[model samples]
Target chain A: MKKENISDAVIRRLPRYYRHLNELCSRGVVRISSHSLGQEMSITASQIRQDFSCFGEFGQQGYGYNVEELKAEIGHILGVDNDHHLIMIGVGNLGHALLQNFPFSQCGFTVDAAFDVSPAVIGTAVNGVPICSMSELDTFIQSHSVDVVVLTIPQTVAQDTADHLISLGVKGFWNFTNIELSSQVPDVQFENIHFADSLLTLSYRIANR
Target chain B: MKKENISDAVIRRLPRYYRHLNELCSRGVVRISSHSLGQEMSITASQIRQDFSCFGEFGQQGYGYNVEELKAEIGHILGVDNDHHLIMIGVGNLGHALLQNFPFSQCGFTVDAAFDVSPAVIGTAVNGVPICSMSELDTFIQSHSVDVVVLTIPQTVAQDTADHLISLGVKGFWNFTNIELSSQVPDVQFENIHFADSLLTLSYRIANR
Candidate 1:
């Protein structure tokens, strides 16, 4: 499928498909049909086919898709085929854990440095990624050419940190702050994962369901 | 508008609107039009109007919505106006920090208890919420009647944890694990936040844009 044709929703589901395929591959499953894949993903078979067809044909009439090849395709599409540099902001509890248990490296993105406002956390290393002061953000971004920033700062400071990163030419942000920053930066692609908002929405669904 | 008429996408965006309005209300902004709200959210004005219309008609012909009233209405729609009990599974770094920071109570969700397998973390309080053993999950959940669960377990254990929670009658899940479990539980609402996938998609968009 052409990258330009892929929707944001489809792109988000690619990693999901990749992770499931990895599990199936580990279990010695060689191939999977769109129907079964859809069943596993709780989506319709035709939806799976349509999503996959956006890039290129990968399924045969009866043979379905080769697990390993599909996995590789998704990995490449996600840019995990090439290692990307990551810099994390806010070495607080969540940030510290993220740095320690960094998952991107396994999927081809590595955290080279971390930044924080806490003096106690500075000069420390979580999973060998050294924590630096927030004052060094511009220098670090310039030196490392950090492509992605993992934001775990407080809600009040999220916008400022985002502005700083964007000023440094950072391409994308994984924002974990509860604050909504849709108006702060228009050019940068931001993925806001508000934990409280998610829980509240879920609660509402469960109560109303 | 009737709650049944609200789409999932619209429901998801309600929180974003709520956050934005809350910020505006705090800043003493009394009124906002659909155009201005859409501008702030990076969405179209008509789309914002449609979403709000699903809840109720709050805007006038020329005038928009009252900032404070809109914020409260959105909060009510999201079920964040009243306090709801919440439980956290996998009290690791992310969990601990989330407990410490993030005003869940202010948002009408409270982290009453946290569960983990580690004995060291058990019986301890991370930001006033008591850390409990995984063995106590059923008891705590049942007694507290927690409607929502915040999952931060490893991908390997996410499915099992979800299954266990579902079996206990938990209806809502905010899953942070990269692993997708859409097929594992069909009835309950599942919101998956894959940080890597978000970052990758954002990077791709930034690179292509």
Candidate 2:
């Protein structure tokens, strides 16, 4: 597989495969063909082959891919090979829940600090991740050199917070603000997880069905 | 937009455009050309025009689109024109937070019921939405015919829960589980929200930058 130029869509699906492979490995499945894996994912075998080929050839024609090896490879490709340091912005209900659950460090990403506007929550800690005031974002980010930010701010302040983070040299944002931020910051990537959008998509599928 | 045969990718982007337009409206922007909206989204004006054209011609060549009108049209296209009924599975930390925050009814979706395995949580109410045992899911779903199901279950039970929902004729799912589910029922749509994937994409972008 090539080390450069992976499509965003393909990159998005790597975790899906990695997770499935992990499950299969746990279930004692040692090998899988692109066809079977694609069947499980509802994608075409050829498409799976092409996506995998872009990274590097890990499967043999007749023998297929080794489940454990494929899981490790996909994990590395998805950049979960190393532990990541993350900070959460807006430690509200959603942020608090995310902080308490989803032990990312155990899975290769760590939430080291949390930020909020409320003084009440500022000094508290969720899951041992210290909650700090938004005023400390720049210093905390600079000192910790945080690699990713989980944005759980309100829709109104989403864009401004994103801009501020970008200016502070933050390269990636996991935005849960429900705001559509369309800025081109040279090396930064933003993933929008809009609750409304998710529900709407579900409604469409249900109505259509 | 056409009411039929809309691609899933296009459907997904409608909410994005809707949110973007909402922001513009809040800022007191009256109208926007497709070119400018496209630039904001990192897409081309013609592509934006084409997407809007699928439903109906909402823009003029010289005048562009009315901000409010376009927002309304997108809302309709995404089927958020009216309120939708939503149910939650796994009423744990994430589920509790979702119920308390992001009240979807305001945006056209309402959380009517929640299901969990915990006896302590069952028969309780979170933000007016009643929590029931998993055993009651089928009856509740049949009675209400919930339009969407939000799955915040653990990874191990994710697929089983999805299967249960689909068996009871669930059409759409907002899956927050780390596990990726492929639909066996063609009408059932599953949106896998991987927190890790977002972090990985951010890490990749940051590293590359």
Candidate 3:
């Protein structure tokens, strides 16, 4: 299927669909109608069918969808089958939580190493990924095949560090830095995780209440 | 302004506008036009005008929007003017990270207290927010008015814990337990922070490359 034809909303929902289907598969549910799936996801069955149709036919008439096959197709669509390498920057509390709890390898990315400026955390390792000094970052990127750099560093240095990484041919960033990046470098693909925006959205809900 | 008439998309963008305006304010930019604001936000000038117009007439025609006034209006609309109390239920690494870094008070939600089951971590205070025992959860809710609960525990007990909280009249949850909750509970607002979804979204972008 030509990706350019697919709307970003459909592409974003692909993961949610994959997640729901995986849950069903784990529960020994073999087949599920779009109507049932719709009820579960709070989206219309027609919408679900339309979304899946964007990637070619995967559902059967009357029989509905096969859980394993549908999930596998979505896994492929989400690039979970293809291995992606991630290098983490800043071994602070947030970084440490992500490095420990997030099953990166299962979801297509493997964190190869981490880098930190603080002397206290520089020589340590979190779950086998060694933390190196900032001096080693440029050389490490040059030597290793790093696909994405996960930034959880301070906002003060976030822009400079991101620009430096992008210059080293790194094309993807999972940025958590509060700098609202893309202000400096505008080229690469980025999934800017703005946690504050999410919090404020919730705050708005309370205020409205 | 009647918030009921506004779309969720507009409300979500409100926080983003607040953030951008805050930056301009910090830089001493007093007034800005829709055209310049749109250019900075990568949104259409007409779209920005439309969004702000939903919350009544705040923009002055021909002159432009006052940066400080616009931001303060958005902040008030988001309920940042009202104080919100939150109880964090799991003092794990993620919890600790939020406690140490996230300025919840600035966003209108104050971290009243934290609770944990780990013997090693219990009886500790993170940034002066005392950590209490799980036994205190029910009693604490009965005594104090907590607007939300931050969950960072294992998925296995997430639903049970959430059910327990909701039964105790807790209406909001900042869940990070990896469980897509909402089982047997109703009428509560939730902002599920699926960090994995954000990561997988980035992975898909990388794989598509």
Who wins the lDDT comparison?
A: 3
lDDT of 1 at B17: 83
- Residue B112, candidate 2: how far off, in angstroms? 2.5
Instruction: Indicate the TM-score of model 3.
Output: 0.90
- TM-score per candidate: 0.83, 0.80, 0.90
Worst 10 residues of 2 chain B by lDDT: B200-209
* DockQ of candidate 3 (2 decimals): 0.63
Tens-place lDDT per residue, model 2, A76-143, is 76667667778899887788778876758645787888999999998988889999998888888778
**Tens digit per residue, CA lDDT, model 3, B1-209:** 55675676787788889889999999999999999999998778999999988888888889899999999998888878778899999988889988988878878888889999988888889998999999888999999999989998888999999999988999988888878888455558788887777878887777665
What are the per-model DockQ values?
0.48, 0.46, 0.63
Q: lDDT per residue, candidate 1, A1-209, as tens digits?
A: 34565666777677678778888899899999988988876778998888888778788898999999998887776667667777888888888777766576766777888888889989988888899998888877787767778888877888877776777788678888866665455667777766666666675676567
Quote model 2's TM-score. Answer: 0.80
Ranking by lDDT: 3, 2, 1
User: Interface RMSD of the predictions, in order shown?
Assistant: 2.6, 2.7, 1.8
lDDT-best of 1 and 2? 2
lDDT by residue (B1-209, candidate 2, tens digit) is 34677776677777779888888999999999999999877668987987877788899879999999999888776677667778899887788778877758756787888999999998889989899998988888888868778888888888887887788888778888866686767767787666765666565555555
Docking class of 3: medium
- What is the C-alpha lDDT profile of model 3 across A1-209, one tens digit per residue? 44665665677788889889889998999999999999998789999999998888999999999999999988888888888889999999899899988889878898899999999989889988999999999999999999889999988998888888888888888988867777344448778887778888888876676
The backbone clash count of each candidate, in order, is 4, 2, 0
Model 1 residue A51 CA deviation in Å: 3.9
RMSD of each: 3.5, 3.8, 2.5
